[model samples]
Target: MQFSIATPTAAEFAALYLETGWGQWPLETFERALAGSWVVCVARDDDNRLVGLGRLIGDGALHAFVTEMIVSESARGAGIGAEIVRRLVGEAHRRGVRDVQLFAARGRAAFYERNGFARRPDDAPGMEWAGESRGTAVP
Candidate 1:
């Protein structure tokens, strides 16, 4: 396995998504996601096929959020995912960004924890706004 800070093309991204049972995102969304990421790291097999991916989206100096972290099923147990997290975290730390965070997929918290992330406290759990919900509450 080899890793590089290269952004995969949309076709590569789509293929991996489908290959891993994650439905494909639209091309435009892929483009926007990649464009908005502060860093993207891709892992390739010996034959140079994209087998793992991870990226950070942040304001470059203060916050870096890890997302879209996936390793192809064939490569799942090879430590590629952990390495990807290390690289992403290394980049953020290098920039002196201390607010790194990620929403681990269900059943994936141990993986992130092993890579040095901690779960949010119950009272400070992450929240998401549903697109269909009315934003009626104001502070």
Candidate 2:
């Protein structure tokens, strides 16, 4: 299986989101959010079908966060996810982002660990705002 990385347009990103069951976000919503992104990476198979996507968002210098990292179920074990993360990290580093972060779901920690991420101390907890808006609020 051949893999290649490219920056995706808003429509492409939204399609990948739906395919991966990340959420049901519309193209307009994706366009608005992607416009603020520092970079977006998409991994595709030889046939040019999108298999994975990840994004880095921030002020384009000091900090960035990885979001929407996902791979299609059919492509999960083919290392596409790792490639997506690797590409996103490379892009963030190239932009001189001093800090990059991502919130991995439970059972997915090992995946990030393999990509050079270390688990933070338990004392430093991860928090989120559970609501329809999906806006993370600090408690």
Candidate 3:
């Protein structure tokens, strides 16, 4: 396995989403998101196939949020995901950003915890609003 800071092409990134059951987000949205991220990292197998991906998206100075973190199911037990998080966090710290945050998938909090993320306290909850609840949900 090899890790690279290079950003994956939109197709490769969307494929990662599908492989991880994260749904196939449209390529155009992905292109825009990728353009906006401050840092992106991809892991490739010895064969040069994209096996894992993670990225950081946020304002450059004060806060950073991590999302779209995924490691191929086949690659999960090898610490690739942690490495990706470490690299992203390292970069964020180097840039003097302290308010890094991420939402872990169900049952994955421990993974994030081990990677130096802590749960936000009940007093400080994370909330979301989905555009006034149109009959359909996009996420």
Candidate 4:
């Protein structure tokens, strides 16, 4: 697989998301998310299929959140997702961002640990404002 910071179309992104069993979302939502991202990294197979994708979102220099690290079902266990996370984190550091964070999917802490992330202290202060208008977006 080849990895690069180039982005894929929203259609391709949504398709890859679906391929991961994450269900479906509108292409425009994907488009807006891509447009607002600080950076996007993609991994493609030999045939140039969109097999993996990762995004870094935040101010370019001081903070970044690594989100949507995705690898197609067929491409899982091949290190594509890990490499994508590495690249995103590297890009954040390269930009001098000292605050980097990511929300790991449930039961996926081991994967993040392998990618050089540690658990936040149990007492770390954080909260969610899950208001009625909030929408669900997870993978």
The residue ranges of model 4 lying beyond 4 angstroms of the native Cα positions read 125-139
Ranking by lDDT: 1, 3, 4, 2
lDDT of 4 by residue, 57-84 (tens): 8986556777788889888999998899
lDDT of each: 0.79, 0.70, 0.78, 0.78
What is the clash tally of candidate 1?
A: 0
Query: Highest TM-score, which number?
Result: 1
Q: List model 2 lDDT by residue over 1-139, tens digit each.
A: 4444456687877777788777877688988887777777777777877778777777775667776687888888988888877777666665565466777787887788787666666785432212121322323
Candidate 3 least-lDDT 10 residues: 127-136
lDDT of 3 at 120: 73
Residue-level lDDT tens digits of model 1 in 1-139: 8998889998888898899988977888888878888989999999999999999888976667887798999888889998998888777666666567778788988777777776777987632212221223322
Q: List the residue pairs that clash in candidate 4.
A: none
Worst 10 residues of 2 by lDDT: 127-136
Question: Model 4 TM-score?
Answer: 0.85
Q: For each candidate in turn, give its C-alpha RMSD to the true structure in angstroms.
A: 8.7, 8.4, 9.8, 9.1
